[model samples]
Target: MTQQGVSWIDKLIWSWAPESFKEAGESIVKNFWLHWFPAKVSRRSLAFNYSFWLGTISAVLFAILGVTGVLLMFLYVPSVERAYPTMKDLDYVVAYGWLLRGVHRMAAHLMVAFVFFHMVRVFYTAAYKKSPTGGSRPLNWIVGVLLLVVTLALSYSGYLLPWDQLAYWAMVIGSNVAKSVPILGKKIQFLLIGGTEIGQATLIRFYVLHCVFLPLIALTLIVYHMWRIRKDGGLACMDQMVLKSEKERVESVGSKTYSLLGITRGMEVNVLTSARAEEENLIPSAPNLAKRILWVTLFTMFVTMVLAILVRMPLEAPANSAVAPNPAKAPWYFLWLQELIADTTIRLGRFTINGGFVGGVLIPGVLALWLALWPFLDKSSPQAAGVWFPRERLRQNVVFTLIVLGILVLLFIGGICRGPNWDFYWPWQPWPELPMHF
Candidate 1:
C-alpha cells in the first residue's frame, strides 16, 4: 500500500489512539471507564496462574447475561398462563431466540460457577487478608460474599420465569425451605410466593426481582468489588512482593533512620529515610492489563456460545400444582441442601427434627456468617497472604476443602442417585415404575 493511501487510515486510528507511551498512560487516567483501573499494576498480578482470571471471567459472564437477558425480556411473558407458551415461541417461533435464551441460561450458570471458584481461589491464596502494604481487604471480602448471595438469588429468581413443572416444583421446594426458618419462616415464604402458593403474584414478584432488583444489586456490588481491588493496592500478591523487597533492603542496610519527610512529600522513604527507586515489578495497565482483560472476555464469551449451541435448555411440561413429579427436586445448585435435609431429618419415637430448618437455614446461615467474619478470626501472619496453601494456613484450607467436597458429594447424591419418592438408587439401576393414576 502507498503511504498516501494508508495516511488517512492511520490518521483515523490515531484520532483516538495514543501515539506515545506517555500519552497512553495519560489516557488511562483521563478516561472515565479506564480510570477505575490503576495507572500501573504489578507483573505478578497479571499472571494467569496467580488468580486464574476467574473474577474477570465472572464479570464478563455477567455482562453476557445482562445483554442476553434484556433481549429475552422482550419475548417472555410474566403471567403463569402465557409463560410456558412464550418459552415455546422462543424455542421455535422467534429467529435465533432459542440461541439467545440458551446463551443467557448458560452464562448465568457459568457466572455462578466462576464466582464460586473465584472465592475459593481467594481463600486458598489468602488474598482476603490485610497486610501492611495491601491495606484492609476484609470489607471487600464481605462485599464478595454478598455478591455471591445476590448471584444465587438472581439465578433462583429467574428459575420461575419459564413456569414449567421443574421450575414450579423447584420454587415450591425453595419457598418451603424458607418457611422452615424459626420465627419469620412463614412470613418469609408468604412474602416470597405472595400468599400461600405459587400463582400469578408469585410469578410477577419473581419476574420483578429477576429483571429489576437483583440484577441492580449484583451490578452495584460488582462495580464496588472491582473498585475495592484498586483501592487495596492491586492484588495481594503485590503486597507479598513489597514485603519481600523490604526484607531484602533491610538486611542489606544494617542501621537505618526513619523520618516523616517522605510522608509529607508523597515519596516512599525506606528505613534509611531516603527515596527508593521506582517499583521494578510495575507495568502500565493501559495496554497490558486491558489487553489481557479483552482476551479473557472474548474467551469466556466463546465458551458460553459454544455451550449454548451444543446444549438445549430444559423445558418440562407446564406447571401443575396438583400433579407433582414423583420426588420433585429443587434446582441443581440447591441439590446439596436437599440432600442435607434428607440426611438430617430423623425420627426418635414420637418427636422428629425439622431437617429443612436444620440443613437449609441454620447450617447454611452459620457457614455464611463464618465465612464473612473469618478475616477477623484469622491469626495467620501477613506472610501467608497471596501464597497458595502456605504452611501457616494449611489447617483452615483443609477444613474449607473438606466442606466443599462434602457439598459436592451431597449434590451428586441428590441430583443423580435419588429416584421416585426420594428413594436411593444407583445411576446404573433402573427405577421401578409407579402405578398409573386416572
Candidate 2:
C-alpha cells in the first residue's frame, strides 16, 4: 500500500480509537462493560505467571457453556422417556449437535477444574487478606467459596440430564448421600428428587436446577466476585506494591522536593505526592488489560473447540433403576467423597454408624467452613499477603497442601483402584467378569 493509503487507514482507525489517555479513560468510564474494570492496573496484575490466568479461563468457559447450553436446551426434553432418545438424536441426527454437546460438556468439566485451581492460586498467594488501603478481602473470599459450590452444584445437576445408566446410578448415590444428613436427610432427598423415587419429577428438578436456578445464582455470584476484586483495590498484588511504595516514601524522606514555582526548570515532579510510586507501576487497563484478557479468552475457546472435536461424550444405555451396575459410582468429582464414605463406615456387630453422614456430610462441611474462615484466622504479617508460600505462612501452607493432596489421593483411589463390587484392585490387575445382565 502507498503511504497515502496507510495514512488514510491509520486515520480511520484513530477516528474510533482514543487519541489520548484522558480520552481513553473517559471512554472506559462511559462504556458499561469497560466500567467493570478499573481505569488503570498494576503491571504485575497482568503477568501470565502471576495468576496463570485461570480465573479468566474460567469466565471464558462459563460463557462457552452458556452459549452451548442454551442451544442444547432447544433440542432437549426433560422427560425421562425422551431424554435418552434426544441425546442419541443430538449425536447422530442433528447437524453439529455432537460438537455442541461435546464442547458444552468439556467446558463444564474444565470450568470446575479451573475455578478450583483459581481458588488454590488465591489461597497460596494469600490474596484473600485485607489490603492496607482497602476493606476486608476475606468477604470476597467467602463469595469465591460460594461460587465454587454453585459451580459444583451446576455440574452435578447437569450430570443427570442424559438419563443414562451412568447418570441415573450416580444421582441415586448422590441423593442417598444427601439422605445421610442428620434429621433433615430424608426431607432434603425428597426435595431433591421431588418424591420417594427418581422418576419424572427427579429429572425435571435437576433440569430446572441445572438450566435456570443454579446458573442465575452463579451469574450473580460471579458479578459480585469480580466487583469485589475491584473494590478491594485490584488484585492482592497491588497491596504489596502500595506497601512497598509507602516504605520507599518513608526511606526517601531526605530526598529533594521541588516547589510549584520551581516547575519552570523543566524538571519532572511527583505532583500526586501520595500516589507517585503507585502511578509509576500503573498502566491503562484500556488497551493493556483488555488485550491480555482478549488473548486468554481466545486461547481458552480455541483449546475447548479442539477438545470438543477430538473427544466423544459418552451415552450409556437408558437408565435402569432395577438392574444397577455392579459398582455404581458417583461423578468423578464426588469420587473422593465416595471413597471416604466407604472407608469411614464402621460396623460393630450389632450397631452401625452411618459413614455417609460422617464422611460425606461432616468432613466436607467442616473443610469448607474452615476454608471460608481461614482468612480471618490467618495471623501472618501484611507483607505476606501477595507472596506465594512465604516463610511466615509456611505452617499453614503445609497443612493446606497436605489436605489437598489427601483429597487427590482419595480421588485416584476411587476412580482407578475400585473395581466391580467396589472391591480394591491394582490398576494393572485383571478383574473377573460378571455374568451379563441382559
Candidate 3:
C-alpha cells in the first residue's frame, strides 16, 4: 500500500508540476548546449525540409506585418483632409507611435525582401520545376510577381503621409507617368484622379488600396503559397522526385523470368538510388530548426521594436489640387527609374528616344521572360535526384549569373537617372522655400 501510494504521488507530481515551464526549460537547456558547447553537433531528421523552412519564414513575416499593420491603422486616418495631421499626431501624440510607425515601415521592407529571396531560392533548387509546385508554377510565379508589385504599392502609398511638398508632387508626377500607359492611359488617369488631378479622391483611393485591398490579397496568396510548398515535398528537386517515383512504379520491368526460372534468387536491381545522398545534405530539425527559427523570429521582433522607438513618421503639408509642387522626387525606391528618364535627352535630328521604354518596359519584359524560361533551361532534372552538379553545370550557372547581373545594371542605371518632371524639376517650389508659417 505504501509503495503504491508513493508511485501514485510520483505520477501526480510529474503530471502537474508546471509542464509548460518544464518543457520550456528543457528547450532552453538543450539549445544552450547545442548552440555554444564545443562538442555540439546537428542531428538530422525529416520532420520538415527546406521548403517548409522557407514557407515558415514567409508565413512568420506575413503574420508580423498583418498584426503590426492593423495596429498602425488605429493611429492612421486615410483622408486628404486628415492624413497628414494624423501622421503628425502619430509622431507626437500617441505613445510609442514612432516605434510602431518604424516597425511598420521596416517590417514592410523586410517582408518584401524575404519574399523575393524565397522565390530565388525556390528557382535555383528546381523545386518549382517539378510536380506539385512545378505543375503550379504559372500561378505561383503570378502570385510572386504580384506580391512584389503590391509591396511597392504599399511603400509608395505610405510615402504621401509625410504631406510635404516632396510627397505631393511625387504623387502627381507618378500619377502622370502612369497616365502614359498605352490605350487605357486616359482611363487610368481619370480613375486615379477622380477629376483629373491628385486631390481628395486620389488620397482616399490610395488609402483604401494600401490599407485594405492589397493586404487582403497578399494574405490569401500567402496561404496558397504555403500550401503549395507542402504539396511539393519540402523542396526535393523536381527531377529527383520524378526519378524516384518512376523507379518505384516499374521496379521489376515485368521480368517473371527471374521468378519463374528461380535463377538462384536473381536480384540485380536496375532502379537508380540517391536516397542516401539526398538524405546527407539536408538541414537537421531538432537543433537547427529550433535555432534558425528562433533567430529569425528574434531578429524580426528586434527590428520591429527598434523601428517603433527610434524613428519618427512624417506627415506632409496639405494637398493643393490647383498648384503643382516643383522638383518632385520619385519615391526613393523608384527614383532610380525616374533618374533614368531624366537623362534621355539629345536627339539625332528626327528620331528621338525615351528611357522609360528601356527602363520600364524592356528591362521588366526581359526579366519576366528569363524567369519563365528558367525551368526549361535548367535541364538538370530534379528527378535525377542528388546529382548536385552535372558535367557542364558551370555554363548554366554562368548564364544565370550574367542574366541577374544584367538586370541589376539596368535597374541601377534607371534608379540613378529617374526624378520628378523628367529629372529636370524639383518637388518643392521657391514659394515653399520662402517659408509661410502656419
In terms of TM-score, the best-performing candidate is 2
Give the Cα lDDT of each candidate: 0.86, 0.88, 0.57
Q: Give the least accurate 10-residue stretch of model 1, judged by summed lDDT.
A: 6-15
Please tell me which model should have the higher lDDT, number 2 or number 3: 2
1-438 in candidate 1: lDDT tens per residue?
345443433332222445776866765755544666787888889999999999999999999999999999999999988999999999999999899999999998888889999999999999998866645799999999999999999998898899999999999899989998889999999999999988999999999999999999999999998888878878998878777767756754554343346353322245333223335677777777878897999999999999999999999999888877878898888899999998888999999998999999888889999999999998999999988899989899999999999989999999999998899999998999986322
Structural similarity to truth (TM-score) of each candidate: 0.90, 0.91, 0.68
lDDT of 2 by residue, 273-292 (tens): 54666777898777678778
Between 1 and 3, whose lDDT is larger?
Answer: 1
| Error at 261, model 2, angstroms | 9.7
Off by over 4 Å in 1: 1-20, 255-278, 436-438
TM-score of 2: 0.91
Task: State how far residue 384 of model 2 sits from its true place (Å).
Answer: 0.7
